[model samples]
Target: MTLVLDKLGLARNGEVHLDGVSASFERGSLTTVLGRTLAGKTTLLRAIAGLQPIDSGRMERQGCEFGLLPPWRRDVAMVYQQFINYPHLSVFDNVAFPLRQRGVPDAEARSRTETALGMVGLSDFRARAPTALSGGQQQRVALARALVRRADILLLDEPLVNLDYKLREQLREEFRGLLTSQSDGIVIYNTTEPAEAMMLGDRIVVMHHGRILQAGSPKEVFERPANVAVAGIVNDPPMTILHGRLEDGRVTFGNDVGFPAPKHMDELSRGSYRFGIRATEILPSETGGVIGRVEFSEVSGSETFVHVVTPLGEAVMQLEGVHHVLTGSQMRLSFRPERLFAFNADGEGELVRAPTTGEY
Candidate 1:
């Protein structure tokens, strides 16, 4: 029910890829290893799959050691960014290949292959050659093949990257179910996309520079990032980091604008503080304290992000629906004090909530 990585470390090309990384992958839940490029997301997955050497670390699953085992000896399957399937093989053949190699009976392999294909919505394409399928369909076939193995652990490394926007959306809605279908197995996925991490990660392991930044539920890490690095990568438009002075629980910005300090930050000494707020938390207001000039606006489907230049710094405010605001126009951006996240110089921090009303 658990795959434990104890003091895991990996080095390559004279550089460290995973430095003392550690986390437990629990069965029945999707654990997402999230980070940007060169963050070791794939390296970590490969190490777990026994494809990459663990320079210094021990990996164990179900109370058994797997550090010295070969990849084929591990009960794991991986789907990659590239849809890797035999060009000459039919979808059904590809999905059945793993079972065939394992010497599974014909009837059992057929049943399991059909089941896996159906899980990926590829049952209809079973007879089609992999070369005839679209990229998304090919990826689905890869997923089906992996699922057919019924491995104890499933690894997906940016499996949706090659798909178009619409296809990505279509499969994202189905990925969660397919990945977690095996209640007794573990699904460990890796992605550089934070929004996707939040969408599918039941337990998100925030990683960067081959290190484990943080691990918690999606809401836990999103609501409270361990540092600026994790906070910077976890949001869609990214959190707006701002520098200001804190005096008597009040932070004053350079634009001569100030607001009550977060209640959670009451214990802090009056001094310089770095914090952040999500784009969606800030808004345009009539009496907003943080003022700025409209830089530009971007319309992303149902949401509109208004970029503004303020005395505090450049900030982005996310709003719903279309915006008629002209660029270069002045606008008042409101800061929701309670939504503020306080962090140290290193950017590790948590949300600061206001005191509950009528508590006294």
Candidate 2:
């Protein structure tokens, strides 16, 4: 079964919420809608759930018009960023609420609720109220509630965003197995974090400025981003874009920085191109050609992300372990030419050449 969206568009108060967005979602697959805030990820999910009305669009599920149905009539379930649960009901009752509303038999409802709670590791908390649970446990209850009904379509809008980092990581690790188990339904998970999107998605739908930017497998999108915009969105620290020129078999960034073009870019007839390299690819070296001054540094967990200003442009380097880099200190940094991504210097910055090496 397939859910297809055609030219979906929505606007409010002169602001475009969705700009001709279109994509196909297949059952049994999880598609992560990835984008920054106000990128219309939630708007897209709301449209699918019939909770948000679109000014122009056609939604078809299994060849039948789907947008015309009311929210209650759609066989869809949604979990929001917040830990939303029934305060008055026990965990078991909260999960069984939908089934009860549908007049499902008490025996079958209990069985389904029990199974859902167990799937989320919440079976032991079935007798407790949502208020008595931790943030993570409450979110799990929300998830179990969503799963208990076995809805045809499942939408999760940053469901783990409210939790602490450790809890988010813990829940995210378990989410893939739990979500993929719903192989008979269409699951769409929305997230602003590129890491979460890449980790959880079977396929990724990249969105920006209310438009569909790119849609493909996580590996495909990461290895070969559609354009500069996609490259910026998919990378955690954002890829460093340097305005450069390619001529005479050499790529040059500024007058002093030049290197022989990698083999992947040999076929390109380029005058000017934008070069991209990930932060992790840039390394500090004593004999490096690029001279940069440390602008600032951020230490995340065991890794340090150093921001530096160079003649070419500002760049970020991801170094393993903790390193205290002083601001305004001169540092030499280098990156392999073969790791660079080349893109057209004009228009949307279309990709000219991707790195030959698959590792990024």
lDDT of each: 0.83, 0.92
Give per-model CA RMSD.
Answer: 2.9, 1.4
lDDT (tens digit, per residue) of candidate 1 on 63-150: 7897778888888899988889998889999999999999999999999999988887788888999999998889889988888887
Q: TM-scores, in order shown? A: 0.91, 0.97
Candidate 1 collision pairs? 226-348, 227-347, 227-348, 228-347
Cα lDDT tens digits, model 2, 1-360, are: 899999999999999999999999998999999999999999999999998999998999977899999999889999998878889999999999999999999999999888999988888999999999999889889988898888999999999887778878887888898887854799999999899999999999999999999999999999999999999999989999999998999999888888898888899996999999999889888884699999999999999999999999999999999999999999998877889999899999988799864544
Model 1: weakest 10-residue lDDT segment is 351-360
Error of 2 at 178 (Å): 0.4
TM-score of 2: 0.97
- Shift of residue 46 alpha carbon in model 2, Å: 0.4
Candidate 1: residue 322 lDDT (0-100):
85
lDDT of 2 at 32: 97
- Top candidate when judged by lDDT against the true structure: 2
